[model samples]
Target: MKRNPRKVRWTKAFRKAAGKEMTIDSTIDFEKRRNVPVRYDRDLVQTTIKAMKRVGEIKARRERAFFKNRMAVSRETQRAHRRKIIEGVKAGVKLHEPMSVESPVSSKVQEKIKVTAKRHTALLPGEGRSMGMDID
Candidate 1:
């Protein structure tokens, strides 16, 4: 039996789309050989990709903040636990789950990111068209 070729991934499509110099009539064809056609207008794809990247970036920043929050909480808990141990307390250490404490600055930044992503994803609705000028 012969093995089939691997399908083109969306990441590759995104990369291709990113570098493409698109025009009004240009389009980004997704899985061109498949029967169930899925296509994107040039402007729409560009905008969507931009929004996706922005969201990813924002999420990355949030992840860093979450880690920082976790570490701070962990350190405080550790100090308390050590103090208890030094005081000759026989009670088992009470572990506290790290909760993300949202700072006002971080919250405001996240809100702005959400607003930007929303605006970018809200593309104008229009008639769909067949893949015309291929970007790939």
Candidate 2:
């Protein structure tokens, strides 16, 4: 009995869309064809293979931060801050100094954003339910 050759499958998308024509993806070495797909995150595969082959050693200090680096508080501190703001306003004091906190987001800014968002959420007079952008 005789068997025929099976067709190769392509499971990879283009690296970057460059006009119309053939795609440039030579991730797999097809000198002798295997049953795997052509290209899928080639750089990731290369790095993984290199890592697998090495007896890995520790590197420099990791700059990455864990989630616990930022502390989360509620109610008390928030209410105190709000009271301070209100007192500042009532005492004829102008809140002009720019509060520069990390990630361009301070508590005051967040409160303002929440207020604006609430105002926007409320339906205007005779306004339809759908008045937002269509992502599609």
Candidate 3:
């Protein structure tokens, strides 16, 4: 392939200014001939462009590092969520309790009036207790 002289000159100029390579796309208009900057010049053709391997390696390394950080954050978030659920269970927060329109003040007062679990209870200790395992 013989590339046009004008296309070759413009491609060289674009690469020199941008510090990157661009291929002359003769199919398109001359003003829009230069494509996006590539890691290696596509004009000279003998074998594969040398810089392509380095560019690919750099991209792969960056992608791996990004996913690694993302996974770490995801794991941390999951652990924190699990810890919160456990703590809520320990505090007697019925995690799976269905929502209903009940008076907040009345419920609080009723909780105080009710006999403590230690003092008196109809059911046997730990007989029907649950961890409220609804994890929606």
Best lDDT goes to which candidate?
3
Q: TM-score for each prediction?
A: 0.34, 0.16, 0.34
Give model 2's TM-score versus the native structure: 0.16
Encode model 2's per-residue lDDT on 6-37: one tens digit a residue: 22222223212321222332322222366777
User: How far out, in Å, is residue 129 in model 2?
Assistant: 36
- Name the regions of candidate 1 deviating beyond 4 angstroms: 1-39, 89-136
lDDT, candidate 1, equals 0.57
Total backbone collisions for each predicted model: 0, 0, 0
What tens digits encode model 3's per-residue C-alpha lDDT throughout 1-136? Answer: 7875444656766554543332333322323445676576556532434455555666567657656876798899999999999998889954576777875576545543656566654545444664444345
- Rank list by lDDT: 3, 1, 2
* Cα RMSDs, all models: 33.0, 24.7, 21.6
TM-score, cand. 3: 0.34
